[model samples]
Target: MKTLTLDLSGIYTAVTPQSIQAWEEKSNQYQQQLHAGTGLGNDFLGWINLPCEISEEQLSSIEEAARGLQERCDYVVSIGIGGSYLGARAVIEALTPSFEAYQTKHTAPQVIFAGHNIGEDYLSELVAFLRDKRFGLINISKSGTTTEPAIAFRILKALLEEQVGREEARERIIAVTDKARGALRTLADKEGYKTFIIPDDIGGRFSVLTPVGLLPIAVAGFDIRELVRGAREMKALVDESVPFAENPSALYAAARNSLYQAGKKIEILGNFHPRLHYIGEWWKQLYGESEGKDHKGIFNASVDFSADLHSMGQWIQEGERSIFETIVSIAEPNTTLRIESDEANLDGLNYLAGKRVDEVNKMAELGVRVAHIDGGVPNIRIVLPKLDAYYIGQLFYFFEKAVGISGYMLEVNPFNQPGVEAYKKNMFALLEKPGFEAETEAIKARLK
Candidate 1:
């Protein structure tokens, strides 16, 4: 099986080969810190070996539960915020057909998401849509009190029970939360809902290999075992023992940091493949949350190429010189499509009629890289042999490992997200939640 490959050649003009090698010793040291559990946020290092550590029994159980959900529900709503839903959604969107949501029938339940947002009309429409469809809920949260998911779960849980009775609702709902405690876990136990435990050692953003992501990807009918196999293979390839020159993760970490040092502050993840859009979202969270700390880290951003080329293209082309780009290049699309020859030639596209559509897209990809590089932006390319569960799995682990190394290179704790709570505190205070009375008073006085 061919693995994902990284090319830092385009970035050579900005980040030299010698510079990358110079960081090798430091990268290796960071790798040692990760392996030795001696670094900051080491407690969350469970994800470092998660792919290899996943047991066959766990895979079997996830598959069995997924099978049960498929047998019953036509639509399964995966409810969670941030890492809870992003990883699974990214994988599911990448693997499933782009038009699966519009399909009248499917091999497995069409997985949907909620609790990630709190839009009034969005929740209203979701509830109304599920009114006639057979649906199941996968409620994911370590603490059941996260406002968004909690509110979503409350409304959806009531609807599920009222629609299918409490007994059946109990069977349909699955809780992925803390094992021994947490509001969700306590309720799951009391209601006898089938459950999966999110590992205490693994943070939410890094929990994709766990039931947090696996169950939804499985419920969508993708191969979880193959995904894990690919990730495991990548895990071996990027281990501490791998030489810096040969290791993609270490090289990527080094190269990006070198670009950062060269005054390039923004890293844009550009992809030609539309299906990989959510993959960009997941990547932003992974890198942004991990490294964007201490006021020091590359700003993570993304663009869907050829499309965004018209919108954000001008800024990227003529704007600040502090930007760099990383492109996800797919060697082969899953389906073959050829541009048809039109006799009228009105659109003036007949000259390239014999080529596959992917060929044109590949040209656009190449063209953009050249244009962007020429326009003073450094470029890095990641080539995937193809898009599938296995390759996507490899990509996941590849980025995860790279972020770990990159975050350490930036001297930040990759695992902890202390800044995320600032908004939550203000929101709670403004809403006058019971526990935040003092905060509510303080905030109100300030408001007045």
Candidate 2:
């Protein structure tokens, strides 16, 4: 791991050592309570080590499923909310070019996400486009009872039945929910849909590596074994004995919050690797949900360095003093296609010479580093050696542990998202159920 120590001078680098120590102590105590009978312990974070929990194996199956869906369908609809869809969407969108493309190495996977929101126009348009077309649905919800995905699944299943006439629709759907059983589990078995589990020990946001994440990523044609390998490596290497002050993950968690205490109310994460943009989304959920409480702490945001250099980059270079940036920098590209000399010079007269992209990238990074330093900005860099399965796995595990420790340091339950459930309750009340209309009208009156 290439560790970049961010200079915290002039910015508040102070932390309560006693508080940090207390968090560590609490984390140690909760390790078993968290994992309980799973036998995975905190070292593996929320991952279960059983053969049934073979993340890599399931991912391969997911890929095969994805290919099957792709061949038979015109579109793939993802149904889930919160961490379920965000992490996956963030990854897919981050890797893909912002402007839609007509060409790629692979047949593009057109992924349409629903159930995250119940927008009438949004769901309505999707339904119209998908009308009588060949499409498949992948729904990720720990409980089949969640209103959003549940509703979307009901609608899509009805459509599937109409298209395939009930018999074939059963095989066209996949469900990723709880391991033992939940509403989703029951539906999967009853409806004859292929199912995957979001490991029981893992909470929603932390359930990324499990089926919650793998199913989507695998469907998008990402290499899942490499992903599992990356995570597994982190499980093997990181230990509590690694000095707290020097432990990369712990140090990262502590320092950012330390700045928060000093009145730096915004933390920006910058990623150099376009592929890992979703990891930034993963980070936002971790930091924001864990720290955004009791009228306290910084807001987290992410930027892709070179691409955003033209837009948000302007403000960041001369932005408000509220942000302390964490640059998730990558040292190498995943694939290097050499830039050939422009023989035709259709766009411009060639000032270009024989040059590897790495050379140009190094120069750009140097320029960004200097500008950031000059602006009196507090920035730390997380240098990933390369973009691959192993490194991403390491980054995921490292960040997950950091979030847990950071939550501990902040005295927040990072593993829980009670606040997220609040809105769902309100939505449930509004939806027409047997006894909902009266209470819903009461709540709606308050809004008025």
Best by TM-score: 1
Among residues 3 or more apart in sequence or in different chains, the pairs in candidate 1 whose N, CA or C atoms overlap within 3 Å are none
User: Per-residue lDDT of 82-164 in model 2, one digit per residue for the tens?
Assistant: 78887677656654555554554456467778898878788888888888877888989988888878888888888878878
Global fold similarity of model 1 (TM-score)? 0.99
The residue-by-residue lDDT of candidate 1 on 103-151, one tens digit each, is 7778899999999999999999999999967999999999999999999
Runs of candidate 2 exceeding 4 Å displacement: 1-45, 48-74, 91-101, 104-110, 180-182, 335-352, 431-438
Residue 143, candidate 1: Cα error in Å is 1.1
By lDDT, the best candidate is: 1
- Residue 297, candidate 2: C-alpha displacement in angstroms: 3.2
In the order shown, what is each candidate's alpha-carbon RMSD? 0.8, 4.8
Clashes of each: 0, 3
Model 1: worst 10 consecutive residues (lDDT sum): 97-106
- The TM-score obtained by model 2 is 0.81
